[model samples]
Target: MTEPTDKVDEQPLDEYLKGGSSVSRQYRQLPGADVPPSLDRLVLRQAEEAVKRPSRPAWMRWTAPLAVAASAVLVVSIVLETGLRDETTVSAMQEKREAAEAPIETRMIEEPASEPSANAPAADSAAAELVMPVPPPPKIEVPPPASASEMPMTAVQRRAPPPPVAAPAPAPLEEQVAKAEERDNAAFVADVARQKSALEAAARERELSASQRAMRGEQAGVAGPRDTVETPEPKAVLSYSRPISASAVVTSADSMAKLEKTYTDPEAWLKDIRQLRKDNKPEEADRQWKLFVAAFPNYEVAENDTAREANK
Candidate 1:
């Protein structure tokens, strides 16, 4: 029973190793961690020594140990036998001989030439330190000649490095939208202000042009008829259309009647005229102001008096 059990345990390991049926896998299932093949052979020798009997048959006593020793040699030779696979021709044999005798480190690094396999066995790490793979020669870039004529016909220039990727902004979508909207509103307000300024500028420019023309006319002994002269209409200032305040009353009545009601309150009348100016109805305000002056020439109101001159 013990013999059968021993055979069963050792059979697969020996078969895989000797038959070259994935020897690495067989080694992987060994009892110890990172147990080398040499160490394994030593351990097996010790195990055989322990299992031997002085009274056993001479044939069995020697044969078992001899078999175990043979297996160990076979394993060692198998790994070293890169030459045996190609024994067909003299050239192949010669190449194999050259490869077989080569240094272990050289054999490990370079491929056996005659074989089609470009694959080299992973060398033992202990032996790898002795002969490191030769470092690739340094690449020294020779600068172009100072004279343009001496420059190469086609020079290989390294491509520029790629631009760094920008990270996405941390702000939320709603915040971004709000910011964009705020910018748009600010731009709109600025444009409106510019347009208003342009209109006001155009009005001043027209006035200056008219004054220049009048000066020219006076120099030529010509007087423009005052009654026929139409005043330049004031341009409307751009502003938001505000909803009427609760306190602001909307009344539909004759301008004269409205003026008469506010006769006792000159400040109220002046405020109404200012409102008219703001509404771009300076001409109507001027007409009502004239009526007020006609109604009360002796009445002295500073605001009204200033407005009277401005209207004229």
Candidate 2:
């Protein structure tokens, strides 16, 4: 019975070692178990929180050490500088103290030595030998004064005086206006003189024509029933005719005449011309235009039908 029981136990053990049990087969056939969704979410959330947890800044990692090192360096430097300052100060103070004590030590030694003694003569001779006589001051030679020819010229003497500044230039606008006014006055005087001469000439011509007419009439009376002679028309006289020069003779009468009112101002003259045109006196306007052009050659006329027609 014991042997059979042993055999039974060995058979079961062999089956278990061979993995041929029903339990093992059933375990292999079962579906694989998965982690719970809640557990998985909890783990993942924990991982994220770990990842997101704020850590010390990278700069902070080195800042403390760097600050420590810098502070150490500063301290070392300060210590070294302080030590050097102290050494220099101590050295200067020691030198000053030594200098201050030197005069007192010298006085002490001289005072003891200066006391009367049995070997006074010997001491006196020793002191006399030790003490040196003061040296005489060096002589300064007086040089003779140099002659003017021998003396070197200074910078001020060599430099020449600056030239005088030139007078300021005249203002262009004022000068132009003055010159234009002078020209206008000259032209006006000349025109007046010319007009006066022309009037005088016209009067003379008319008188001569009348005298000839009378003489012919007398002749006709003497020679009766001859063909009637036609009297020639007198030439048309121009107003404001003038030579352009200072030599023109302007009489006081001409200046005082109503003709001077025509061209006193260029604008006024233009207005008169415009007025003449408005009044249907084209011939008179045209003649005034010609005079205006001659007087003020550079003046710009206003664009109008009258000016255009006159220009044509």
Candidate 3:
């Protein structure tokens, strides 16, 4: 049995190597072993039909997704539009409500004013009385008075003369005149003193100017001209006073010039005003602020930059 099995396997291998065997030929020739002619024709026809048929457009692949996306976008837009419309409607309704309530509120406020109060009756009665016309006074007719000649004389004609009028008591004219004379004397004395002081100041100023001129001339190596006529020193009519120095006058003038400085640039002016405030010069700051307003009327200023005191 082992020998027969080996022989069978060897026989098939030998026939396969030899190209083919009768059984292989018989299998190949079987009714449905190879594809039928009709099946080949049908397959070829199907292949031809597939090739001839037009392919779907490339864009068709995205149609469903694009449609879905468009639907989603349209839905979102509609929702947003609806929301906006709702918001607008709500706002309009709110405005309408406010407008409708405004008149009611006004009426409520006006009703109290229109209605009569506790004192209305008394005020109305007083007004009515004032408005009413006044009645005319009754006329009284009397017979004409008898003439003076016909009138009876009760007493004799002798009447004592009226007492002589006394003159008004004299005012304290002498005392008043003396007081006025004293006041005038004092005023004259003060005036004289003031004039003396002024003259002294002028003399000092002239002396300073002369000295400055002399110094300048000396520096330049030239002789300064001297006045041929000398002004006499003014006599101290009332009292002598110390004269102001040239340096003091110069310093005061410098300060006055600084205070009177004008600012053309608004920013610089504002900066200086702030600096004044920082330096604790509120009065100067306020004054400068007023000047700034006058200089630039259209310039806007901050509230805190105004004067520290409300009254200012």
Give each prediction's root-mean-square deviation over alpha carbons. Answer: 39.9, 47.0, 42.3
**Residues 82-184, candidate 3, lDDT per residue (tens digit)?**
7766665555434333332332233324333112223344434443333322111110001111332322221111111212331132234334434533432
- Model 1 is weakest, by summed lDDT over 10 consecutive residues, at 240-249
Q: How many Å off is the CA of 277 in candidate 3?
A: 46
Between candidates 1 and 2, the one scoring higher on lDDT is 2
CA shift of 20, model 1, Å = 97
List ranges where model 2 is wrong by over 4 Å.
1-43, 53-58, 78-82, 98-312
TM-score-wise, the better of 2 and 3 is 3
Q: Each candidate: what lDDT?
A: 0.37, 0.42, 0.41
Candidate 2: pairs in clash: none
Question: Which predicted model would earn the best TM-score?
Answer: 3
Give the best candidate by lDDT: 2
lDDT of 2 by residue, 157-268 (tens): 2122222321143354335435543433333333333333343344344455445655555431222111111111111112222211111112223322222253433344
TM-score of each: 0.18, 0.18, 0.23
What is the Å distance of residue 244 in model 1 from its true position?
Answer: 26
TM-score of 1: 0.18
lDDT of 1 by residue, 239-285 (tens): 21111100011121232243224332233344455556657787978
